[model samples]
Target chain A: MSEVRFGILGCANIARKVARAIALAPNATLYAIASRSIQKAEKFAAENSLPASVRVYGSYDEVVEDSGVDAVYLPLPTSLHVRWAVTAASKKKHVLVEKPAALDVAELDRILEACESNGVQFMDGAMWLHHPRTAHMEHLLSDSNSNGIGTVHFIHSTSTMPTTQEFLENNIRVKPELDALGALGDLAWYCIGASLWAKGYKLPTTVTALPDTTRNAGGVTLSISASLQWDQPNKTVANIHCSFLSHTSMDLAICGSNGSINLKDFIIPYKETSAKFDFTFGAKFVDLHIGWNVRPEEVHVDNKLPQEALMVQEFARLVASIKDCGSQPSRNWPEISRKTQLVVDAVKKSLDLGCKPVVL
Target chain B: MSEVRFGILGCANIARKVARAIALAPNATLYAIASRSIQKAEKFAAENSLPASVRVYGSYDEVVEDSGVDAVYLPLPTSLHVRWAVTAASKKKHVLVEKPAALDVAELDRILEACESNGVQFMDGAMWLHHPRTAHMEHLLSDSNSNGIGTVHFIHSTSTMPTTQEFLENNIRVKPELDALGALGDLAWYCIGASLWAKGYKLPTTVTALPDTTRNAGGVTLSISASLQWDQPNKTVANIHCSFLSHTSMDLAICGSNGSINLKDFIIPYKETSAKFDFTFGAKFVDLHIGWNVRPEEVHVDNKLPQEALMVQEFARLVASIKDCGSQPSRNWPEISRKTQLVVDAVKKSLDLGCKPVVL
Candidate 1:
């Protein structure tokens, strides 16, 4: 609560939003920022209103070594997430790695272990789950008034690929270590986090990955799809999909038992709403939208990045949990590591095994 | 356990398959057949090699009221499912009604309540879950070998449409009681059953529906889409876009952490095994089918339904579950009822709200 001091690892666009969020949070402050280039870092430091005492490190190692930082926010490429996060944690700084902490699971597990052994905090920066919209979604989904809309079964989240590529987006499209998964690693985490949060964090019992690893200028995914099941008290299954090759997906589509809620275009201001299907006893008619039975309506617009803000606040909240909550730390480390690895491993398996299901 | 003596409520196509399954399973028998004409019922009874003592009824009411029967299979039009099933339950008989048991939630609820209160059983004759293919899907998704592929995320299941005359022959499409829901109700249930059974029987917390209710000379959906979320231990989700309008949609696409599996024209089998999309995780490059992904080298198909045989074994299993395990009745009643009503209500609400998320 003592002005949660924060440091950012890059000057990525999202980093700007996240930094802005840190500044906006009443108890949070953007105290430091680092980049390979001093000019960009200086620009970010100045524009974001960082204090004079707040320093810019040309090297991330310097930033990670900085004792002034309490939490390190990593906003680097998918491939670099693990290396930097583990380094930050080893230096005893709490880490908030960007969504998809690593390109694959083995690396993710290592980072998680480093956090545990080093006794530092670790959180995936999937901020959407922290948004009020998500809280409302959880409330809407769990409310009995929705009647039999029991489990949340699917999430379709598509963040349109940036038309204007940044200078740093190299090797994302066609490299062995860094391949098509950049899109999946980036956009998919939202769907994963959203679904995980919706199901009250039920771990998937199984996973099967399907990737649209179409090479070259054709780009990432014409469309990619995957499926998994959860074994728990209620027993649920899910399918999540992400694509960076199309203009079609603009939102998250959440389908439940009793009805459906669409968080239209989560990355921008777009249509958002909930819809129900009609079925009365023996005398009613089935509902139809226009000529069809399904359609979307806008109920809210998230013009601001509340999720990023809440994510930092939640990180703040986690610090409290580590000190006072149950015997376990604020986050479920082993579980998160396993699940994260499960996703990345699933992706690798798909490329190796030709995209059939494998048990988690 | 005493036999679950099933009395047929119609001479519909699916009834014959159920009858055959009844003959194969323990503790169940197809005792009678009912139609508008006793001749049609008698003919069906004879063709299927039923006992001469098997009664033929000219009206559905007689079959529901028969004291010799323990349960009645209601395969009448969508409009009549609730009326007959509830009445049969009221008469202290169990009911295994066909899909989309009612066009709306109110009627479906009434029927459910009636059956629950009467201490009789109720189930939807949803067949796919009873098939072994889904079990394989469950296995592939949960196993760890498939992990590098990432989590199973998205799937779209589609079933093709029948012509105007064909739809009118089916009660679900032309039933005045169903009104606008028609095709959405028809096609949505299969996807519902798949998602529910895949989840080990849990309802969705969020449902987003978008329907194409255009009648296209057939008074049914030309295209329909829905977004579902099942956020349990393993975060999962799906987008279901179907068409009673498409000439063909014998496809179910599922992606996983390590791979993906697809049932080719499952409900209505295509002519060749080559029509399938059975995939798993691996590191080699794979070819892509124009419309669907093709990874046949590593594909493993659990069961491929010959359109004719799809319902036969499932109906048998439902009968066996009811008779052999009276304590639990049908293994899938709660799941079936919950999913059926969910889809029905979702369709109604989507129509009313113009395809928006209707919180359960």
Candidate 2:
């Protein structure tokens, strides 16, 4: 289990953040950087003080075909998510693409076929799932005896990239196509993944999108909602909500037979910042004792072991597994890509016919 | 100044309550009883203590044609709602129909035309608007300064007969021809009307229904949701939620910028129910002092009057108004019926296409 040299694809803000964590990660090395501009890539590699043995590549494909690097991280635009990821996977290189992975399903299928046949790994980097509190929360929602939650109910989650007039000038996520994908690919995918993964259901049979088709801000839904059946227990139903128009602290809640499991915010890394878990159960007649019923559980931090750093370590380990064992759990590209594409297809179909049930 | 002699259409439970209220009304008098079965009408008239001077009619048309009866109250089955109401209106009598004025939009239009041409006042028995508390709650939402409700975000008003296994009955509101108007008509209509009237918005450009369909005794999702824009002081959007399957609080909230005004159980007569209007502007940040910059206020209420009595009084007053002026505010049958039909059509369309946006 020696370190697998990791080469960054593009110098995205998220890439920089991840690469910074990779530097801190044990058994991981930032081997090289590759960009469309060779000068920029070399500068990025030099600034990071990459090892003398590590070599920067001129083209994206060169990095994928590099003999030294074991994995390539693709933080490319959503539209090009599949193109490069599939190219890298087909070259027998393990790949980690950004959320959305592909704009639509066709690209996703190509990536799935390429990765499976080439004996390489392919996974979308949905960082929210890596957040430590997510698993503990999933357990609380899943346990029937806990009575902390009943039949799965409504789920709504929102995240905001807070900025002022000064920052808006430099912000690229606001550009229209990016805005559409940002709203869907950025915040929505997390909710989609969490809603499906935690509640144990697939993409909704029905969906809709009210993309802000207004001038200067096209292809973005200021707000979109769909009524859905999540196979609610006791013959009930569920709805998964996503929006990026406004920031809401209205976390996720599972209303159940006896009580409810209310999460503070499921996306953000609990160990990276201050976080707490809340659980409420009992009859509806009883008033919600804000923080009373919730057992005050501060996400315990190992002073010496950084959890986010550990997540990167785990990702590196996953990369090594693909190089050593031909494939890994993370490389189950067909399954993950299929689920991700199903959600994207549902949203797009909703936009076309107003909103309709689109089976995955 | 004299009482308008009113004829009871049938011996239904709702009709009984209404008839008793009419008997106690200062300007209205319950003078006769009518039923398809004359014997049943006589027994109903006697048990309800009808005046000895009043006559009993064997047929509904006979009751409509009787000069002795100044007005008719129709509380028949869903299919017969429009037929009987229109017949009585055509006979030059003021008509008050039960909860749902018509089973379908076309029927509502025919009923409205019949009433208008004959100069007969017609109204649906939606008395919740006349409640003082409901009116006051609406006023509070409109005020964002002292009241602190910023932007009215969403109002989820659910009144489901969840435990009542009455879906076994053949309800016209649940009919397929009604276009998924089951929940929209049966329950969500109140939420829709209350929100629409409160916000004073005439048109909703788009509507989408999520897997919107009809249900039977299994408690269909008359859970309808519509997002309408309120171009008030600030650009505000509202979600009026209504459902039948799940038990929801009988309340509405003015979810605003600074705080929220949750009208506690609007179904209870505002005069008799104890309710507290609270403002929680920015409760998310602990050290933020108040939720918003403004001082928060809490007004507690105690209902001293019988709750149902107010709607009864409003109906009686409207009855007297039509008797004097040939119409009342609630007697704008053309507008009500048109709006009802448009919404019903939209619901059906939304359901057919998985709640796509229906342009107004």
Candidate 3:
């Protein structure tokens, strides 16, 4: 099958990564790039070492309208996701948009609707979900044998990055005009998405923001903490903390009745070639409760391609099926994104309601 | 100085561990033990291979009244703590009580007042605090140099252990008559104590219980989640989850502006002689954000004595100081215990108030 041709909607910092991902994905190829200014797009292409055959456009509209492009990756600001993603989907180009899919689920719904109407695939840029390590962990979580971590009881996750004073004041992520939701959207998305993914995409019964929400001068969240509780008999509770003011930490821990899965660099691997997570099954205290009977076993999963490239390969595979075999777009990716967005919205509402829990 | 003779109040399962610790501490000795039944006390001594010099008594009052016993270790249930701890303190025997300190801060205060009035040293048995690794982490946390994880911003910890249906139905930990606080007291004590220790024992401004409180049939909490938020300029938030329903997990992660410290076995090390934690200092994403610039460095600390023995040695040293050097008892340990109990009480109040936030 011919490789899916990709067009990037913007020359944002994240676009550099996705552009490289497109080039590396065996089933995908970088076909076009764009920026508000043609010179900026050309500069991005040159800086990222894009092939000479890659076209540079001044506006995102050209990328969406391109006849040869099979997919458009939108690395635009959160506020612009709806406008550009809808445009790409309406043009029959599969949409791969940066996270915090939109400002809220309402805007994300419009983008989803456009994709459904146009028969185009829609997937958010959560590269970790595509990592082979995730699949390995899922196996352990789902296995009915002794290998599985039995019924999940609690999950804890965090996404935090230290920011410079200059970035906090001027970066698009912290700017209301560009991101709006700030750290809540930019960082918590990973934590919330991870919690949902750990629970097989089951929505929580309620979302409550903790009173520790810190805001920037423009009232955009700088840091936030929230809880998502699922009712019985799947009575699992997840705590999520995301901040723009802390040192780098991407931790995820899921505890179940018989075991637990833990990873420190969950959002992004410490290295691209392989990732490791600690899995402890049937852990119990030794006699006299002096120490654990068994220590956590480190499980390392090697991937031939980086997680982002794998994401692109998977997305392009769906695009190829739709284009070549007349198959429908995959609903799995869209459903995951939509559920994540709904929880994100609930967290925002809870924050606005003075941390009172918003029942789903 | 001569060894501080220790008397065990009850032959609970945990008492066996403490008896070994007492025997191991160079400055402590197991002098006597009582279990409300002379036969049970004798069986405990014989099963534990206790020294023939050790006295076996039927009543806790006999051990408290014995002038040869310089310190009394209370392994009694939460309901019996105040009565025994205060009696031991009034009798001028230094007290080393199991955690939860007491049913509440009010009951704990009676024990503290008695200790203070009698000039008997008081300390709770949170053995992890005495581990060399804890001191190593504390050094990093307090360091003014780049080695320090600057200005703490977040802490996440969990203390969970799987329980059998039989244990859940019959264990004293789940019985309201013996341990009304249940998991909140037995498990959360470690998590809460770890968080406060990470923050240098500073009290949080508010304690809010999440709506995920699960209770046993006797109205004892089987699982609970809560948040502790500090106000500016400290501005740190801690999330803690404790349960008897999950597999064993004792995780603590502290994130600051410059670094993070994470350990999966914070309360009790997987091994006894040496313990390790991951310290990620000055971490940042590599260019293009493909991976972290630096992975968490595993920092290991070794100790000659087991943590429990070290705890006993420290307690005995403090007792020896007051007995031989005519020095006043140290105020630090008692203060730490008081602050932890206060937070525990606040969480209980919040749970009772339907998971409302209780201001300090």
Single-chain TM-score of chain A, each candidate: 0.79, 0.81, 0.99
Query: Which parts of model 3 are misplaced by more than 4 Å?
Result: A143-145
Residue pairs in candidate 3 whose N, alpha carbon or C atoms collide under 3 angstroms? none
lDDT of 2 by residue, A120-199 (tens): 76667765555555566666667565544544444433332223444333344445544345445655666566656655
* Model 1 error, position B49 (Å): 40
Off by over 4 Å in 1: A47-51, A143-148, A152-180, A211-213, A217-223, A230-237, A248-250, A266-305, A320-328, A333-338, B1-185, B188-360
For B46-109, candidate 2 gives per-residue lDDT tens digits of 7867778767878787788888787788777556777788888878877777656676678888
The positional error of residue B117 in candidate 3, measured at the CA in angstroms, is: 0.9
Chain B TM-score of candidate 1 stands at 0.79
Number of the top candidate by TM-score?
A: 3
Q: Put the candidates in lDDT order, highest first.
A: 3, 1, 2
**Alpha carbon lDDT at A105, candidate 2:** 75
| Candidate 3: Cα lDDT at B283 | 96
Every candidate's DockQ is 0.03, 0.05, 0.89
**Residue B189 lDDT (model 2):** 63
In terms of DockQ, the best-performing candidate is: 3
lDDT of each: 0.59, 0.57, 0.93
Candidates in order, TM-scores: namely: 0.50, 0.62, 0.99
